[model samples]
Target: MSIRHGLLALLERGPMYGYQLRAAFEESTGSTWPLNIGQVYTTLGRLERDGLVRALPGGEGGQRPYAISDAGRADLGRWFTTPIGRADPPRDELSIKLTLAMSTPGVDVARVLRTQRKATMAALRRFTRLKQERAADDDLPRRLALDAMIFRAEAEVRWLDHCEAHLGRPG
Candidate 1:
């Protein structure tokens, strides 16, 4: 998720402590992607080490404040503008497991697909409910994130249906 870059973008707004940064991040996107406080601090430390962020001297807040340097701004800009290509070697754990199942003898493919369909429907329902609940927020970023979740869930549901319909049927 390039959380380090996300933190840099937040810091660009102004100097902020880790807790404030965490809250700001969660609020801005409604945290479709969650982050632990420890992870935020870890990223902050890395940014500081990388000369992207500098700690305020003698600050005594529960979470220390950091300001973005010019280098940090440049890095944030570069990160945002960079295009992300598909990973050279895709790392899909689900695809790997399904491949093994398909190869193994005496495995009921329909049963496997039905089980996955159940799970996917549950997830789809969850996302749908969340989207309905957020319908009134009217915040662009949060709305966009919710919309993304809904779209992905719907896509998974369609794929599950397709898999179930085609299982064990050779073309």
Candidate 2:
């Protein structure tokens, strides 16, 4: 989820002021993804300098709107067609936490897993509540998004259970 590229996609829809882009991105993603307006404007400026967008002068007190250029459309098309191969190193946060836990001689690994299990279960419950709230509001899209989050949280909880189960097994 590159906010820079996501902003480009929004501009491709039509010309938009920076604030509009920020709001649309947040709403479309159910407010799960956060964006900084300053960062958006900085990226928009770079896009303009790169010939991917053109900034039109503001009207009176209104903000200046930016539109995607022909070059920008082409760049977006290339991005769509290209596969995003993994170039950056992977980050396994849970593995790192577990490694530290193993190194701490007095650390209780089971206690750590139990704490994580409780947190993950709480997350799942929170997401479920969010989904129910969205359902009551009759917002299908947001409910769906919350459902995905709930499912992911439950999956992690299950994985924690498996890890705990194997903690004392023969190597």
Candidate 3:
């Protein structure tokens, strides 16, 4: 997730302190991805430096609130309109581990695949349960997040099955 864009989007609502921004972020995303307080401050500093956000004066106590600038609004607009590109896909640690297992000596690729499949299946079940609970409450953001996780877990299981078959493992 782009913390910069996320912060900017939140700032669109109004000026907010670092802690407030962190809470809003987690709340909006249903806590699927928690933000570190330090990270929030760091990103805020960078945004200020980039002129995307300006620190407001006279914050209560030591807290420094920030507001989005016009540039930030334009950038946020572009971010919303731009489609995420797949030209450079993010690295998958599981894929890297499996590739290394294939060539590593005395390493059981089948065992590794089986273990990952089991774990992924467990995660899928958890996501499904969460989805059901969220659906009951009509929590749209969390439900969407859970759906994404479920789909990814399902895909991982399918890939593991393919790997097992390719490695001559019995079904």
Candidate 4:
């Protein structure tokens, strides 16, 4: 996830202190991605340095709020309009582990796949339950986030099954 873009998106609303930005980010993502206060501040500093944001005068109790600059607004707009390309996908740790397991002596690839499948299934169940429990009027962001996770988990399980089949395991 792009913390820089996330913070810029939040600042698009208006000026916000570091704590407020953190809380808003968590709330927007349904707490799926929690941001540390320090991380928030660090990103803000970078944004300011890049001229994407400007730190306003300190408010009461010395709370320094940040507001998005014109460049920030343009960047945020680009982010929203651009489709996320998967040309360079992030490295999946599980994929790396499975690949290593295949080449490592004494490593049980089937057992490893089975273990991951079981865990992924459990996560799918949890996401499904969350979806069911979500109220109709719940924020769309949270619902969409949960749906994305559910879909990814389902895809993972399918991939695991494929691996098993290729290994000559019984369907």
Candidate 1: lDDT over CA atoms?
A: 0.83
lDDT of 2 by residue, 1-171 (tens): 667678888998898998999998888678866789998889998998999999887644678899999999999888888888789856767767877996789999888888888988988888887776677676666777777888878888888888888889977
Q: Write the per-residue lDDT of candidate 4 for residues 116-165, one digit (tens) a residue.
A: 99899999999898888885746999999988999999999988988888
C-alpha lDDT of all candidate models, in order: 0.83, 0.83, 0.91, 0.91
Each model's TM-score? 0.87, 0.79, 0.92, 0.92
Model 2 misplaced stretches (Cα beyond 4 Å): 59-62, 81-90, 136-141
- CA displacement after TM-score superposition, residue 166 of candidate 1 (Å): 3.5
Alpha carbon deviation, residue 28, candidate 2 (Å): 0.5
> Per-residue lDDT for 1-171 in model 3, tens only?
899999999999999999999999998887778999999999999999999999999999999899999999999999999999899999999999999999999998989998898899898998888777777766787778777888999999888888887898543
Poorest stretch of ten by lDDT in candidate 4: 162-171
Candidate structures ordered by TM-score, highest first: 3, 4, 1, 2
Model 1 compared with the native: what TM-score? Answer: 0.87
